[model samples]
Target: MATAIRRLLTAAVLLAAAAAAPARAGTLPPLVDVAWLEARLGDPALLILDVRGPLDGEDVVPFERAHIPGSVHTDYLKDGWRTTVEGVPFVLPPVDRLEVLLGDLGIDETRTVVVVPYGSTSTGFGTAARVYWTLRVLGHDAVTILDGGFLTWRADPARPVETGPSVPEPALFEAKPRLDWVVDTREVERALRDDAALLVDARPEDQYAGRTVKPGVQAAGHIPGALNLPESVFFVPGSGRLKPVRELAALVPGTVRGFAGPIITYCNTGHWAATLWFVMHELLGMEDVRLYDASMVGWAADPKRPVERAVPASG
Candidate 1:
């Protein structure tokens, strides 16, 4: 009972902090625009994580040069947040490892984490979504993604940017895995047999059609019976912003009805699929969504698994 009460009190305090944040009216959503983030730059409960890519395994010079004030830098590519298991790349690390990682970054259950990416393209934005998904899978509910990310932040010269490393006092991070949000190869195979879930392919059209293939996977085609909604469709190129919810929903296939049904999203290594999961669950408010974390790499590892490519009508 004491633990329950403490949790309730912590929740209340976080809620009050959010309510008092300088954000624009209507409250913050899972995706916050630059304007919204700019307004809440000093909220004590807010933690901005700038996950810029470390090109060619080099140092994070871009983050070292400038970042949002009070933000911390973590190289998404270099970080062990995603790892390989049995040759499958980009799989989530174990719970203890994630706890140490998040704790070292000064994250805790009480804080509201806003993941920031470079926002150069869908690929960059996917970094934010993948991190956001990781936090969610670890049961961190008070997380959001910075729409337009650091690119949008820098576009506004007036917004303050800071240089030099900012060391934060570490916090105790507790990992509470939400297994329902994750699925594996066996579960996906069962879903295919039972027709119990809508499988959404987050790969590009050519990839989904097996015309283009990514390395590290045995098969080029997508899982049989999956719907195609390439992750790139969610972003406007060169704009650094995701499409509005109405626009995103319009892109959904007409065959799929209702947001409550189970939907499993997958890409080559779960990187792209994280973007789709964020769009459907976080932005669209869809429920019963899960990510195939192993994605195509794991699915295609076995020779027995089936892959299907939609053949364009012969011209």
Candidate 2:
């Protein structure tokens, strides 16, 4: 073969290989039952992470003093997964920095991470969902939330508990940003106007209405015509689990009626948004759900957008 022809053939082979390979899409692992996790506790590929933090200024370390054995401690607050960009709260760190941090935490491409938050459910436990969001956006396909979080783990006396940190060998996990997992202000603005997508605001009634909002929001109300199912509703105190799937299915607006358009879940700074996304993507089995990582912090920063809230939304 001619030299030029040989080079062309090589280039074609490379192109074909690239096209034929799987696109490396992310996977949303289900919320595991206690039995499921207990069964998998001894799996070599699994790592349990505790994401509990101080509640109402109480020291979190004390709680960690008695926690599930074989669990690694990770503080979503002080560990520096976020930074303040123009005062938008807790923005995700750059991919390179995140990759290093995950490695230090003993998480890697091959690990199946299970994160447990401070609470059994969503009472001030948005941090767990936030960390879950971080893992998902970083192209991890094997992350699961410990069903009902730490509270459930605590309730069962037989479940093993230990004090302090559990360390592991530093790992080498490479995280490529999956931008599709997240939506930005532009996409949100379009979702607000578009007839297809649903924009679910996970903020409280006060924030949703014009009563009170966190600082720096452009306007006091919700995105022009967004649905309001504040994150709190999803947390059922009785079960320690998220609301029953049937209850949630009926509660979630767009899912029941065959309206499976894209969902963009958002809250003040994306923390609560993660909870909403978790409920939809994991519990309710809603498809094509995405998070606005910047969330209201980015949306409300702009003057062009309109916030409108009048009626209280219910099931």
Candidate 3:
């Protein structure tokens, strides 16, 4: 009983602080740490979106068990974040659907959204990145991701965690879609034909080399002229956290670093490609970086499209 009272008192203090705080304006960073979040706990303009889900053998922890105070929960995998359109799986949902989803979450242009993932693996981090990309493509610039996610937040015992569900008051969320941030198969073909954009394949080397293929994708190799750079390299070794900016820049090949053309990133289902897109577009601040959301699955569905297999060097 005493513990419950203490928790309530902590929440009250945070709420009071938030009510007294002045509104902040200006651009938000692409990523924020636990310390930065903890300081802004009760701010009314801040909305903490906890997107925890089953990924990489980790069981989903119920939001009622424990979550950051004032944070809302949404399952990244099961939620209507992505949908199939014209047989292409995992493509962005329609604008009206996205508007309803965001509005239901009490997300509007006035609030700054912070997306938190499970942060257990690189794939798990991709969930947050994918959501971030969705928001950016929707023309929402007041968004940022929680680096290291809930795992890092839970690592510290000093941070206050609340139990029970959080219900947000619904708000009107308008969608302002940005066509340039997303590219279609026709656009990709045109770019390839014109040698206009640098295509990047964010898949494992074996898959990129045609040695392995995913289940749903029809092709066994990468898009022709695409450079292979697996998304795993962006994360720190054995952790979900991203590497420092300088280190991340160093990982890019000289060819990619020197290329001045627009860049298009893709993977099997556009899941992994979202991470690469986040790194290049958001973290690196590269201009004209776009995501081929349909990715290999859509590309290979057309048998007429060309696929390339990297020739192995002779021993």
Candidate 4:
């Protein structure tokens, strides 16, 4: 009982802080802000990636022409680091395919790749978060997301953006799944029953209520006992900055409600879940956080599983 109270108190404190704290407009680790990015524009070990995919715009090169200087181009929407999921559209690729793809992008275990998306939309950061989750799942921790995202950088014309692609020698990015970084459908099966795991759905309410399950998924509901906390909830609108830690506590109830030590975030395709990963793992300073890489598409596809459209019982 004491432990539960303590966790609840901790969560409350986090949320309060988040709500009260001043807005910090930027990314995690305090290293991805514009000042930081500006300072490291020419660093060798750091690799900048303009991952604005084939956006609905006028021309390709035209967009690339106005990117952050020294930033390389990669269609965050196109060049996927994944392959067949046996069923789903955005399933994670095999380890080998992922490694080869990263290598081709000139990314290796050593390079500190900073992803740049087109706008502050969750879509852009979602893409970056997905890649970040991939690296973490593959066992690399040197990754970081641009807090304010690409549009923030471009908003300032004085800032530099190169016109072409930047390529590097293929580097070996090894894969050693930190199973703890992610939880699969089977694990969710058990974790749902376990009081220790906080099942957080990073999707919006409509999806949680059995509306948008995405194509190919067998169901529209959510994992039984999961809470609907969309990934966008944590962000300070327009800025990539997350809500203050304390403030988030109020918005996101902690594991105190008979919940467990760590939190697991999930969405239909594992995309929005990555945003939650950034919020919980990096912003709120929660270490025992994991992203459901397979998410709902992987979970509901199996006929053996059952989903719940209503809010889980807190009692």
- Candidate 2, residues 62-149, lDDT tens digits: the string is 5547877788887677887777766666678778888888898899988889888756446446777778778878888688877777
Worst 10 residues of 2 by lDDT: 17-26
- TM-scores of all candidate predictions against the true structure: 0.86, 0.81, 0.88, 0.82
Tens-place lDDT digits, model 4, residues 5-75: 98777766676444432232223352266777888888878878666664323333345457777667666
Clashing residue pairs for model 1:
none
Model 4, global lDDT: 0.69
Best candidate (score: TM-score): 3
Can you tell me which runs of candidate 2 are displaced by over 4 Å? 1-29, 55-63, 120-123, 193-196, 215-218, 238-240, 254-257, 312-315
lDDT, model 1, position 105: 91
Candidate 1 runs further than 4 Å off:
1-27, 54-61, 312-315
| Candidate 1, 158-259: lDDT as tens digits | 989999986876999998898789898889999899888889889988998999889988888999988888888878865447987666766655454243
Give model 1's TM-score versus the native structure: 0.86
Flag the better candidate by lDDT, 1 or 3: 3
Instruction: State, as a TM-score between 0 and 1, how close model 2 is to the true structure.
Output: 0.81
- Compared with the true structure, the alpha-carbon lDDT of candidate 1 equals 0.81
Best by lDDT: 3
Which ten contiguous residues of candidate 4 have the minimum total lDDT?
19-28
